[model samples]
Target chain A: MKLHTYFRSSASYRVRIALQLKGLPYEYLPVHLVRGEHKAPAYASHVGDALVPSLETDDGHWLTQSMAIMEYLDETHAAHPLLPADALGRAHVRALAQMVACEIHPLNNLRVLKYLVHELKVSDEAKTGWYAHWARSGLEAFERQLALLDAERKAGGLPPSVFCWGDVPGMAECCLVPQVFNAQRFAVNLDGLPRLMEVVERCNAMPAFQSAHPSACPDAQ
Target chain B: MKLHTYFRSSASYRVRIALQLKGLPYEYLPVHLVRGEHKAPAYASHVGDALVPSLETDDGHWLTQSMAIMEYLDETHAAHPLLPADALGRAHVRALAQMVACEIHPLNNLRVLKYLVHELKVSDEAKTGWYAHWARSGLEAFERQLALLDAERKAGGLPPSVFCWGDVPGMAECCLVPQVFNAQRFAVNLDGLPRLMEVVERCNAMPAFQSAHPSACPDAQ
Candidate 1:
């Protein structure tokens, strides 16, 4: 497998973490998003969205979208399952994942920031503010969901979840770790989200997550 | 099942279509997003993000995030499968769905637009421009993916996909139809996306999509 990735992209970082967790080996193909490499014909014509973290499978299928790609990896390589076995458990984990994927990262990605600065002509201060607002609010939601899940677990006579859902760090961690990384990078307020921050700390301690960090990437500046 | 939804929310509309497709009988509980009902304690205290289109399952579990909720419904009911049976096919379908879900819808949602206007003070004209730009560009990407999938189908000696994957309108259509609904509402230029529009027309002809239309909702103005 070959992953087309950008070092600092949260989506790319997500796929990298998934690959590491599953102990899958893949060549890292870096696309310089800031340099307009993703828009060039070489990359754009082949990939449908011309987006980073597109996984070129061993069988030559090119898959885009981090959530879809990570799910695909889990389905195909079932050694380290990313989702839970039951339906409702899967739903809980996925909702936590989407809180970052859909609600937060989409608003703070490089392109959206570029649009705000260039098209809307917003100042640097406003740009950072926009990024921080979404990250902080989205993390707050994540923490609340964690609390709800914890209460549910207690009610069910199950122990508190060591990770996002259970004792294991699965799909939700793959998303949350990268998002918290972005939050810290932008200096987003992370004071009150203790549950989310604890999950982040647990994930960062894992070898897989540490291996997948942007700083460890070959293209990291 | 009871769905907490707003008529015009694309995410809510997506779940409505999914429920209709599955033949699931769900009570529609409308949450007026524009009126700030979603943020009220009655809704916010129960829901993780207090977002619309939350599915309160028969067992009384509140499922949030349209993608996760739809998948949960598909898994529990299993009567009308939203995803393909095979792994790769599921990935392809999911990536197509995320093209709209994760990429397009997030940027143009009510909250983001409100932030642009109230917080950043962007003019109405610029706000509309921002909406059109993301919608048009995102649709262009969706069109490109459909084309790529079509070619892949032909190469594999299979018939061309009639409705985003096969003859049936599945998960991808559930997401695409609502997004196109929003695109039309915003008057985003839909000139170049023939394949996407064709799917939209086909989906509109179906009873499920018709029943899920925003105008059919009791709360729609």
Candidate 2:
């Protein structure tokens, strides 16, 4: 298998962590986002969107989108499943993942940010402020969700579990670590989010996550 | 079952189609997004996020996130399944869905657009441009993916199918209609996307899609 990835891309980071967690080996082919290699025809043909982290299976099937790739890995490999067996539990895990992947990260992507400055002529201060605004608000909502999950468990609404679903850390943790990383980088307040912070710390301690760190990748500066 | 929804919300619209496709009876409990009813404690408590289109199941479960809700419906009530049976096919369908749901729609959501103007102080023209930018780029990518799928079928790489996955439209078309609605609203070009446009037209011809349209709802103005 081969993964076309950018070292600093959060979505690619997600795929890397999933691959490592599943103990899957793949050749890393760097597609430099900063250098605009993704926009070239050869790369774009493999991924219709010209996005990084396109995974090509040994059978030559190319898959795009981080969450989709993660789900595929979980389904095909099944060693370290990224979703719970139960329907509701799977829904909860997916909701947590989408809260970050769908709601938060898209607005803060490199292309979107660049568009804000170059096309919309947003000032530097305002741009950073914009970043912090979305980050803080989204994280606050995420914290609320985590609190609700814990509260549900306390109230006996959910079964006792160490992770988001049962004992396994599925898509929720996959998404949480990166958003938390970005939040810390942007200096967003992490106060009053003990449960969320605890999960982040636990996830960060894993070798899979450690290896998937953007800085640890060969393409990172 | 009850669905807390605002008729004009794309997320809610997707759920509406899914429910209709499955022939499930659901009470519509309108949560007026413009009136900030989603933020009210009663509604916010039900859903950790102040997002709309939360499904309250007959078993008293509250499901949030449109995609998650759709997946749950697909799992628990599988008469008219929305995902392909095969893992690879499911991944492709989901990738197409997220290409719209995560990539395009989130950036152009009501709150995000409001933030663009009020918080970032972007001009109305620039804000509209921002909306069009994402829609255009996202649709262009979608077209590319569809083209590849079509090309594969033409070359006998994959089976020829009526829909994104097979006979049923699946998540791809669930996401596609709202995006096309947004694209038309933004006046983005649809000139190069014959396959997608054909699919859109076919989907609109179905009662599920027609009934779930924003303008077809009681709250539409």
Candidate 3:
């Protein structure tokens, strides 16, 4: 397997963590996002979408979209599953993931940021403000969700655990760490998110999460 | 089950179609997006993310994110499955879905549109151009994928199918309809996508799809 990835892409980072967690050995084919490599004719011909973290399977099947690619990997190699076994639990995990993937991350992506500066002619300060606004607002909602889960557990509605769903750090944690990282980058306050912060700290200590950090990758500045 | 939805929200429309297709009866608790009812204290108290299309089950479980909600409904009510039984097929369907959900829809969403107009102060013409650009580019990619599938079938690589996968629309068509609707709204060209257009036409002919349309909803202008 080979992954077309940009080191600093949060979506790519999520896939890397999933690969590491599953103990999958794959070649990393770096596509430098900063250099417009993702939009290059050669790479775009294969993926068609011109998006990074496109995984080419051993059988020559190319997969795009970080969440889709991650789910594909989880389904194909189920040793350490990223989703829970049951239906409701899986839904909760996915909802947590999408809260970041769809609602937050897309708004703050490199392309969108570039559009703000180049196309919209927004000042750097305004662009950064936009980034921080989303980071703070999105993460606050996530923090509330975590609190709700805890409260539900206290009221015997959900099971008590260290992770988002239960014992293991599944898709939710995979998404959470990246958003938290982005939050820290934007200097968003983490004051009322102790539980979320604790989970991030725990996940970051793991080798899978540690190895997937943007700064640890070869392509990072 | 009850769905907390904004009628014009593409995400909400996806889930509404899924529910209708599955023959499930769901009460629509309309949250007016234009009036900012989604952010009302009452609604926001229940929803952690303050996003629409929150599905509340008889069991009192609230499901957020249209994709996650659709998957949950598919899992619990197995009469009409929204995803393929096999992992590879599921991956293919999901990748197609995310091509719209993650890539196209996010860029043209209400918030993004508002950002373009209010924050960036882009002229209506330029904003329309931006919308058309993403819609056209995204549909072009979708058309290419469909064409690739057609070629594969001719070469005996894949079986002939009425829908994106086989038989049912699955994840791909769920996303495709709204996108095509938006594309047409922006007057994006549809010359090269006969297969996609055919699929869209077939889907629109269905009662479920028709009833779930933006115009059929209570909040439609």
lDDT of 1 by residue, A80-106 (tens): 889989898899999999999999998
User: What TM-score does candidate 2 reach?
Assistant: 0.97
User: Whole-model Cα lDDT per candidate?
Assistant: 0.92, 0.86, 0.84
Q: If both were scored by lDDT, which would come out higher, candidate 2 or candidate 3?
A: 2
Per-model chain B TM-scores are 0.98, 0.95, 0.95
- Which rank order by lDDT, best down to worst? 1, 2, 3
Worst 10 residues of 2 chain A by lDDT: A156-165
Task: Show model 2 residue runs off by greater than 4 Å.
Answer: A157-159
Q: Which ten residues in a row have the lowest lDDT in candidate 1 chain A?
A: A44-53
What is the number of residue pairs that collide in model 2?
A: 0
What's the lDDT for candidate 1? 0.92
> Which tens-of-lDDT digit does each residue in A1-221 have in candidate 2?
89999888889988998998899999999999998999998898767788878999988788999999999999999788898898877888899899889888998889988998999888988888888887777878888887776666667656666765567777888888888888787787778877778788888888999998888899889
- Give the best candidate by DockQ: 1
Q: What is the C-alpha lDDT profile of model 3 across B46-111, one tens digit per residue?
A: 778888889998978777889999889998998878898977678778888888888888888897
- Please compute DockQ, using alpha carbons, for every candidate against the native two-chain complex: 0.85, 0.82, 0.68
If both were scored by lDDT, which would come out higher, candidate 1 or candidate 2?
1
lDDT (tens digit, per residue) of candidate 1 on B41-80: 9999878788988988887788899999988988888888
lDDT of 2 by residue, B1-221 (tens): 99998988988988999888889989989899999999999999878778988998887777789998988999999778898898888888999999998889999989999998888888888888888889988988998898776675566566676876567787889989888987897787778887788889989999999988988887887
Model 3 residue B196 CA deviation in Å: 2.3
Each candidate's interface RMSD (Å, one decimal) is 0.8, 0.9, 1.5
Docking class of 2: high
* Superior candidate under lDDT, 1 versus 3: 1
